[model samples]
Target chain A: MILRTLRLHRFKWLLLTGYLPLSLLAAALVGDPVRWEDVHWLDVFGEGGGALMVLTWSLLILGSRPAGTVSNLLFIGLSLILVTLWQDNLDEFWTIPDAQLWDTWLENIPMPVGMAVLTLGLVRWYEEQRVLMAQLSQRERFMREHRSIDPVTRLASADYLNQQLAIELRRARRECSPVSLMMLDLDGFDLINRRFGAHEGDRLLQAVTELLLLNLRDGDLLCRYAADRFAIMLPQTSEAMADLIASELTSAIRHFAYRSSKEGERVTVTASAGVALALSASPEELMQRANRALSEAKQTGSGCHAMAG
Target chain B: MQWRDDSLEATWRSPDTPHLPAHHHPALLIELAHARGIPEHRLLRHTGLFPEDMRRGEAMLSDRQYRRLIGNILEYDTGGELALVWGRQSLPGHYGPPSTQIHNAPNLAEALNCLHHWRHQLSPLLTPLWWHNRQWCYLLWTTAGAGRRGPFLVPAAMAAVYGLARHRLARSLDWHFLFAAPRPTSPQPYEVNLGPTVRFGAGVDMVVLPVEDLYEPWPGRSQTAFTAAAHEAERVPALNGAGPTLPEVVYQSLAAHPETPAGLDDTAGALGLSPSSLKRHLRDYDSRFQALYDEVRLHHSLYLHQVMGLSMEGIAERLSHGDRANFRRSFRRWTGLSPAQYQRLLPE
Candidate 1:
């Protein structure tokens, strides 16, 4: 893409290449060139490093962007900045006479002017990217269409959860941030099924799920992990923070007076949660750890557990 | 505390953005500013807008850029009053397919109907939320501009609608305009654009109209011309993000019925597609059938309780919920608000 965009500015590259040689020629003719013994290698390395970076940026931009007004401005600005660096480096190799004032004309003048053009291009590019992001968001936002919805809970299924977990993990890794997972298992759900009739138990589970969702922050993902279990992915969250959120969820569900669907009766629902933090862990590994903590909570009859792996 | 529309953030929209929506005529809008005494070049300058950029006659502009231009004009004595004049002079003529669609409709109601249906064809960013009953029609307008740009557009749109009613349909019905923003110290702008009946600090920005007068026919009506114009409007590409697919149409239909509207087969038949084919078409559109149905149900739940101010039980019943409490929980999940509370906080 960068190459294709740079191809449009063929004349600019040609002129840039031509200008470099002409400057070198001007330096070679202006005064006596430095002898091999006197040439300071350190100055060449210092100035050359900065010039290389700038030149690389110019090439990268040209290659990545299409032929447009902004790209042209960027190229011109970068080219000017590159020439300033080149002249500074050139002064190290060759001596220029003070009478000619060629060094000032070549070096001092173009730096600010070039910088101004680059700034102008950057502003326009920002505008372009904003428009593109809005246009792209329409298509991108729906990529995960939530096709695998669980019939009973009316939330996305375990498979969907895994897919979203993977997506979130990739994003988190790119951003170098932690992602936390919350797992909730209804305490003594089987007993509710046995006591309140399976129908009432289903309603209780649905109500509990809704309660968890109500407490969830925006951009949190909720999914049905099992028959009476739920999983939620909290992006950009640490283990301690995720544990705090799990406690909030446990309390919210604990306090919720879920009513029976078949008959109008208040059914109390309490949940045990396991919060797991991701650090060099795959989605499956993260889920396994959370489920492990969840089982431990169920064993110990504790409200929640935080697993910081 | 007063309800505010400032919750409508302008952050996502680019500041000093170009590409104004197609509804506003650059030549006409710029010239209108000129007629109001601000120089044309001054209007175009610094906004990165040019007369030539709009020469193709299909230029789109973001609200930010348009706001800057309007802000510049507002610097003069006629500053904030530019909206009324812009609406008065620029309606019907400067607007494109929407204006043409208006004449094709048999009456004001159908004209508004055509406008709503083909709204994206008019402009991508300009969306009008319409509510009506037997007695009155209320319209709330939104442009893609950030929320700060909203106040300027509110008066501009209401005045333009007034111009449309008076000039095109030749019907002068009783109308009241409301602004969600606080009332200005000088109320002359509101008076001039909307006359004496304007209300500000009302917690909703809308134009209210007598429902009966909307049925009034245009000054000159022809069935043949109306049909031709409506047909043409239908063919225009909707720039509003992939346009409304069949599933979206079904979702919208379900909202109005207020009951279990229809199954997939029946909805498919209505849209002239086979049930299996409808499923495939939905897949093509990247939508699932049941999800669309649920989405519409949730959307209408919010719509009924918030926009229509329906009771909790009423909205609950409309969605076919077995328990209103269950519906309330789901509403909380969706928006963190119980139905009644959401209704109170909902922007008018």
Candidate 2:
């Protein structure tokens, strides 16, 4: 960990260490010697302590982060202040000649300048934090909703659908693999709920979900896109394969005899579907394209429609 | 200290329902706002909470409302390491009664036990599950459906434990943290705060500790104070069915086997129950064990293969498959591509 930090802030550390030799040379040239009787242990502790604290803070910031603009600013500022503190603390043990002005310049110059740079670094850090929080929020939302289930159909929810689609699209882009989405909508589902009770409609939805799941390929993720609309995410599937699945789904739904528990009556439900190959990053956009095709298919009264976008 | 004294009277709430005031420490909220140089009124806006509520018990808001406040804070502020900052500032006193009991335990084991027993009172989010052999102790943490707050919650929980341990035992204890999530781009804050031992993309969010660490006594351990604290802990509201639910048990069982799945009979035997009894328990939870098993398998495979970067054979061996060929076939059937092909699809 220390090694990583050293590497991250090598320039700052080098600059700080470079002063050690200069200080030693200046002390040697001064020729004034310190006596045991003249030593102020209290001043040594106070000045030395301040230098050590600054060093610790610098190490902490450097160790935790990689080289970035904010980190660079912080390290530079901290090092500047650290040098000033260290040189002032050294005056207690060694004497510099009264004629030499370098020590006084070192003691006074870096204080306000260091503080100004540090203030700038802190301001940048605050801005950087806002971006991180947005990213954090997105990450947490992704984790929570990644495996969300639709209570009605016992299928994956729209959130999960979008997540999977994003993954599939990235993979598709990488491997040049074809992934497809099938959007299926039950025809006039509200009419069924109005005619029968909502409970009966719910049972029909469940039965339809079961039928869809049974018909789906092992790799397919069937998701509830919205009320009465289902989405199937098919990975490693060709355009031809997607068309076959869409037609199969349309026929299967048409053949589905959903019985209402109240009247024990058989209700035949027909569905229109639109299939699209994965082409974009935005799951919403993909869904919209599929919906448009479905709406067009509905106008023609066709059971299924396939489009490449 | 005065801010704490003033805010301490605000009621500690159960986050189980959306109705209660989600935060236990309003002072922390004020401090977070203050750090950002935001006004207290602006911070409390839409939360139906006032900073004055910390003094006089008037500001009460639902979980939904509190979440909105968090959302607002997040929206305006420049990106900062909010979770680490929050964790660093988390004092045990902010957690109220249950925290006192957890803090005063004679040793780590008793402290952990106290924490486990009173967890529902502190927060409904984290439930620490303990598993140990003779040498090492494993405390696996599972979430109680705390969705979007998970990013903050995980680190915050770690910070709390870290602070408590440091205060009580000094540098006497040795432990490392493991998280199931993939490593983030900026791991510096986590590395700095959690030290070098933090591992991401691991099996579970767990704390690995030597068995000896549990026996080390806490400074200022008192039996009298602990007993009183525990007594007060009991007054916190608990769910009707206090024991582990069947789904939770099944999830644990599945989580235990990332490479090899345990059969129904085997899992039942492991639980010291018959297969029928296991089935009955699962039925009471309104879910089939098979469905739960599939869910766990799907989630585990995604983590191990995608995040942990394990080979298909390695995953198969972990899942306990005898034949690599059989595993390959099953993998293909599940994903519509061979393991190697699927791997090629992922970025390096």
Candidate 3:
């Protein structure tokens, strides 16, 4: 993945490489080799270390991020800072002519200028993250772990749900608030796979995830608990309120007209949900209760069932 | 003389015997992975086969080749749902008249009987053996040279059976699943596909169902179609090709005389073979009589202790262990944990 990203920034890589020769020529033209006694090993160590760290940061940004405004800005600012630090480290080895102050200006000017550009890049990055966080609100709660995201549905996986449930339960306990979990499963999902194919089934899951996210409140978190089953974590929700939300979710999915991309046939599905409100039960027990209630709902052909702990 | 045919069956055909039709399980698996965007070559890599092999009119896969195919698919599988999904699509599948026989059964009980009777054709990997007590019926899954692929194959086979049962009944039946394997990191597939009443790390792999549920008539039963399908199925040879493998036969004999604890000589005599011949036949399937015996004994002791609610001393006495201490020692050796520790690992 990193190699692919780096391949996309060939021009940026060329610019980064050009810095080496440019700095070398500038230092060699107007500077004399310093005496061995005059060399400050301590200063070289500090400045060289800073330059190396900044280079690493720039490479990481180039490798992980797309060639967007934020990445370009961050890359440019770090490169500038790295160039200045490289100049400072070079001064310990080369003694510049007294009349030539360009080397001194090179060390002094770019550092502060780079700081300003870096600040601007950080500000833009913060704004970009806010928009992404809003979009991911349904998938994640207070934590973000990329590994926990499901590849097919782009939703948090069951492991993430377990971790978030633990935190939510603890917070609810301390704050004396109710936290409810609703387990939702699409009815006869296997039939859909058998009819169309698993690819269509995966697309249907992604569409259903979107539909569920649309119906959820701002604070509600939706996770893909497993294949064809999803879990919603609702804080400060009572059992009655949970049942209401569960029914809304069921009705939303029931009405969704998912078109199969292969055949373009309109396939509709209903969902069964089981809601459980936390009292003092452990997270595992609470999840079990919700899953059992889901089984009950499925058996009885109910839209939703609530179990109060 | 009685053992001549059995011994010959074992020696002539090993795990390398081409028992499974390429179009059935192998094709179904390839289709599933292909739908999920996995290329056919990747799923068939190192399995010494090609996508075209499945299309050949009468291509077949030996147990070793099928195991390799399963291992390859599992390498690309995440979250462990592939096997369950495969199982769901497996049964009532197009093989021959047996699929029709299973599909046209009168009830879940008859459908299950068809699966058991035609297992050599339908489920060649694991042999399904069922028996019922007064209240509940137990469907036991015994391996037939599954080797290292047992874990993956069992769930898929179980899911196939469970999925068919649900489809026939149009509702989830009240059943409890027991697996002799450890619990997976994610149990959602097992719970979602097979319902939530599942237990792992049990001493046996089986499913327990209420006897009443078994006899409940499915809505789509057609007596004429069922009888016709059965009559047609009889003309087709058992898909295991040669016959029952040695491991399955050994498992049956050991399971039949669980309390008596048959010695190698006794079992060999029962099968009409000398002890060395029986031993060599089992080795062909990558199995041993002692391993099969230990498995049966372990299943019996755990069942008595956990399911039947027998105490340690009572179980030891029933199994003919002289004392609780010897039973404890044997149990530890079998499961790597004391009986109490094993129980602790079990789900409530």
Candidate 4:
């Protein structure tokens, strides 16, 4: 089945390149026997160009779409119309024998029939596409607003944290309230990756991010800092409250059991957390203090919590 | 778990694992090996299948290959009732004949009765009929011992049975059908093969036979065959064994200790049965033990992840996994989503 799909995709590209050139060559070889002036060349060019524009528009719709029912129908319809147009264009060059009245009917009647069918199919296709696009747009909007989110974990990144910090800092200053920051670093994360594969380690990080998000207050903001570190911003909270939250976060990480995929081996993961007060201090200063406290916690060993002095 | 019979272990370790006899059916071969304590891999290898091929459970082995493998296993297993157990497990499409007969029957009621009687010829994992509005009717049947095989096996088997039954009926009747299940995400072969309206996670498998066809007469002698097939099917034991069996001992042990190295042979030996016998026994119960273990583990893991609100890393830890990625894949298989997506499904 996988091979068949690959072949289908391959054939689509092959047909695009191979058929266009072959069709053009056939048209060139079957050049007009009558002088170019004898036939209605201008009318042929105008009609052909109009058909090409319609065909190009349909092809664009097909190209921009993901494989789906409406796209497939549109593609089939476009192919039929294109085939009919090709036959119509062929009449400008070659004159069939007198006995072949069927070719003349095929050349003239099929194009209009094909065009009508294509137009009908496209209307249905457009309606279907609109519905799908609406649903897709919701997801797209979510993704766009959360572009700074880690796709694998759906957690905010460091850049998001910085932006949120700036916005919240202004709000806190305006409201005349305190906001605090917490930094958490998973201890021995490198050792974890070394023991298990790096993939498992990444999973551990993702899980940790989720855990932090779950534990955060409604107004709190969380972000992934480094590979194994995270930062959280607590609004309308004091240093004492941040200290309590940081301790809870540290306990959660300490209790976390990271599992291995290849073999179901469970390894306990611990984290060291640091809390710093945001008492009218700049974001950078608060961040620096939190980092310092985090370093202190790490130095103190596994599952340690440190508060800015 | 101590190895009860050293000879069975020897056979498993031996280079030339016993193969199924030529005349034996594929279902019988599976039953025999499962009954005798022969590992699926050993039987599969003797049939010219590599260990890797066993992983692809959905891939159908030809009847010829199935027969050859069973023949080899029967060659070496002489002392046990494993062959009988194997026979019970190996019955192909326990519903194959009856399903076909049912389709040929004139009326839906007759067809339903035919199915009810003959369903036992296959594995007993399914209950052929259930009480619906005070009348006995074909409804959902749960596969026992499913945990031992793999999480996907029972669902897959259920799908195959429905598909096969639908194909047989389609041959005789011009009617549309739909399958409702929760796991299947896309509609391709399922739609084409089972008829449109393939809904997933629908809670159960059911056939809404055309209401008009309820009073139609049997087309041929399908009614007689269905009755005879049902009686014969009753004598055919459930895939695993006789009587009410507990969850395979290995599953309990593994559930108790998910991190333990409870491979196929280890669990079989622990249960005082051969691996082949255990597998066959599981089939009768409408399950395989290995699959059960995985299911239990996954269920527990998911419970911890969602209900207990455990972190993925923490859940992985309890499962004895060293990493979360492996947990994510296993969880996805269990619930058709990554851990993050599953978390999203939970109410805030």
Candidate 5:
């Protein structure tokens, strides 16, 4: 059994290693001469590298691409070119054995035929590579954007919010526009953890995140600030508008049925939020003021919203 | 400390289902049986194991039964090697072919790779191949039925094979480390049997042989035949219709003290059931309880004696003996040899 397993692995390697060498030798035996019957020797020299250039280019192509149909096609093309060069090189060495001109026939037809087939393969390969690269680029872009989003709630994280805040703050300053920050924290989150369990607590947080996102305006940005806390950045909005949005968020959380594991037990979940105007302060300072008001609201009771002083 | 407290409570409140014995871990039982030369049927009889019950492969014997069996074996077997040898042989499939393949490998590394690749075919439930300290190689094989035996049997088997293979090669096993992560049991057996020096539960079941052993061509096929003879040296007939059922007095005594020398005379004297009459009743169930008791006690004793490190005196006490001397005499009479001699023959 062990020997068979070893042989199987060895067989795979042997297939991979032998294919290229055998292809190259076969091509060499049937390739056409580099110096064509009608073309001048100086034309080949003027090309600077001739058949060697093709060899170098094929090596480069093999090195750059992963193993696939494109590589296989390129390898076959290169092998044919190499074989043609080898046949042309042989003409400089041995005389023809028969008057039948078998060497001329071997040197003339198969090399060009192989090159034509290889060219067709290369065209298909190029088209396939183009589609593959497009898919790869789209995947890379999605991954890059996904890094900024929260995994659990699919909302933006604090880092993303801060970047958006900086941009909105700059635009507000330039255009004499206004922006407001609304920070909300869940009430009795620790109590919920103690009562139900961490898994349920996580589920409740996800529910609240969805509620807040639904309550916000299309232009507003919602982000998770800390455990059981979230911030919404509303652009071109006044403190009064932010407070109204905060109230809507509070009401939604209050009405949400956070089901407990215990039968017939449903907890009325609520949030305390605070709104701060970015009228005469930087985005960071505005965020700090909103956080202070949120803390104050949380201390007072559930469903309370306070404005930054 | 808090976790331990929780576990203790959980263990106490846990259901006493036949599948989850309070004391005997099935993995440990199989391990001990395999380690000791005692047959599986004998081990089963002592533990009150019904082959049909174990069909699902999760049936467990009570802790009391496990402890009694281990204690009995230790008291009866002094050399402490039989359990280990039994463990090696009970491993599913023939070890000879694999051992041969590994022995003929160019190097220890290649030999281990071979064992790793092919071990699954031998026992599907057995865990994948694992290494310990770069010297020892370990593979786990699930028994015919799952959860019917403990992992202690694996280490015993490994230790035995390591010792025997080294001896066969005429070199020290040269293993620097050994480890296994078998299912947990209350009283650990590997610690006592393999050695105080070797580590257990580091990761997986493993045997630590010298790296050079891979290059050594396995001793000729003749060595395989010799090993087979040594392995099968203690073959005991499966006790069929040879033991009492639970309702009978002899059955009660045997269950109460599995390690008690359950001779026909002794059981007959206690129950007022003449030896002949008792045998007749046992025949109805297709078993004699006394023979069942001996088989069970033999298996239990080997495990306790070799794996659990229980002293002979302690085992004798558990077996309900009046004294240690009597237990020794009885043990000798049952097996045709002294407990110490039997233990010495076990794999180290």
Candidate 6:
């Protein structure tokens, strides 16, 4: 999978690989090999290792990200750092004539230029993350831990929801505010999977996740609780408020009109929700209550929402 | 004499039984993982099987390979719903003769009997043994040779049974499921697949079907098809050993004579085996005599305490415990909870 992602950075990799031979050719033409005793093994190891480490970091950044201005800037910045470090390491093995002021300039000029470019890349990367963080506010809150993100929908997993719920419950206790948890499940999701295969089912889920995320409020958190169930944590929301939001979510899913990626066939889906208001209850208890309510709503019919007493 | 010995081996399904169809149970796991976009090769990685072999329907997997395949799928299972989904989709399966028998059974009772009779072919991983009281029929789900994957496989097995019955009966059966494992992180899978009457952290894994529903007539009852399928199923050879597994034999001995607090030697003697040989057999099944003994003892103790409403002292005396404190300590050791605390988790 990482290799698949790295395939997108072929040009960057080609440039990096091409640099190695060119630099070797330049050093061989302009300088002579130093005596074995004159070579400082320690300096060679440090500079060579530093350059290799920078190369790995550059490769990782390129592999994980798509081709864009930010990625290009990062690639260019890291490439310069790698080049300067490589030339410095090259100095340990070859002795250029003292008349070679250009070699000194080659090492010093790119070092400061690379540092500036890296700083610019970092600023852009930070800006990119800020925009993504806004889009991800409903999926996570307070902090982001990559381990907790579900691979399918890219929403937070149930365990992450519980962690945030505990923190929210603690805050609610301090502020004396209401907190609610709503569990929404796609109706007959397994049937859809059985009919169209799991690939299409996964695509439908990804589509539904986007719809739910779009409908959710900024502070409210949405989590993939289980197979077809999603849990939304509502802070400062009462049962009545949660019920309204639950209906809205159910309707949004009901009217989603998701088209299967394989056949482009229209697949209509509906969701049922179980909403429970927190009242001095632990996270587990609150989740169980919401689950029970959701089951009841599902038992009644699709596109229905129920509130726990 | 050789024929008799072979028949005895055929009476029980030992862990090494390679009777499970490659394209059936293991294929279902492969399909479920594949549906979530996990490649077939990844699911079959290190299991030494291929999609072509499974598709050809010529390959058979032993309990060991089945365990490995399940482990691989679970390694990629981020949502933890694969087992439940696999279970829900497993019923009325494509396992040749046994599946044919199930789909044509006259009633729920007949369908269950067919499953029990052909368990080696139908459910090689987990075995379903059932009995009835006045009000309810208790279907005990025992791990045939799942070893550490027992808890995961049991739910799937139960879900498969529940789904098969529901499909044939054309109505949802009220199955009160008791799982030996603790409640999971989420209950939606159990609720959606098995229904709401699920109790976790029980002493044993079982499904409590009300007797009234057991004899309910199935809609697709074909007498001719049922008999023909049964005949075909009878012709199907045993995968490995066909009777109760090594653990099942030990469980029966321990459960039957719960009053003795039978040590390994005594239980081994009852099964007509020497202690060391019995230990070796249990080892082959990935089990220990002590674990099976503890499980059976726990099963009885819970049954006595919960159903018979026996107190700590009475239950201890019944299990041949010399003192109440010893029983309390042992119960705590077995369940990691004192009797009172454990009972608190039970429903009133």
The model with the greatest DockQ is: 6
- The docking category that best describes candidate 3 is acceptable
- The runs of at least 3 residues in candidate 3 whose Cα sits more than 4 Å from the true structure, single-residue gaps closed, are A14-59, A79-119, A302-309, B1-8, B15-23, B27-45, B49-61, B72-80, B95-98, B117-124, B182-185, B221-246, B249-289, B298-348
- The CA lDDT of each predicted structure is 0.65, 0.64, 0.78, 0.53, 0.52, 0.77
Chain B TM-score of predicted candidate 5 relative to the true chain B? 0.32
A-chain TM-score, model 3 = 0.89
Q: Could you estimate the TM-score for every candidate?
A: 0.36, 0.38, 0.79, 0.31, 0.30, 0.85
DockQ-based CAPRI category assigned to the predicted complex of candidate 2 = incorrect
Q: Model 2: runs farther than 4 Å from truth?
A: A1-309, B1-23, B26-30, B38-45, B58-62, B66-80, B88-91, B172-174, B236-348
Candidate 4 docking class: incorrect
Better of 1 and 6 by TM-score: 6
For model 5, the local distance difference test gives 0.52
Model 2, span A100-181: residue lDDT tens? 7878888889888898899999999999977864543312223345335544565666667777788888888889887788
lDDT of 6 by residue, B276-307 (tens): 98899878777788777776677667666655
Clashes of 5: 49
Question: Per-residue CA lDDT of candidate 5, range A1-309, in tens?
Answer: 334433433533355357446644544555443344544556445332455676676656665555656566666666566555644544443333445365566557657876886798789887996786454331121123556555445565565666677888888888887888888877766456535644466677777776776676556777766456777888899767777888888988888887765564888788889888875576667777887787678667778999988
DockQ of candidate 2 is: 0.01
Compare candidates 3 and 6 on lDDT and give the better one. Answer: 3
lDDT of 6: 0.77
Give the per-residue lDDT of model 4 (tens digit) for A190-235.
4564455345766777787777766776667776654566778887
Interface RMSD of each: 31.5, 22.6, 2.1, 22.7, 25.2, 2.9
lDDT of 6 by residue, A213-252 (tens): 8898899999887777889999999767887899898888
Chain A vs. true chain A, TM-score per candidate?
A: 0.52, 0.52, 0.89, 0.56, 0.55, 0.93
TM-score of the second chain in candidate 1: 0.61
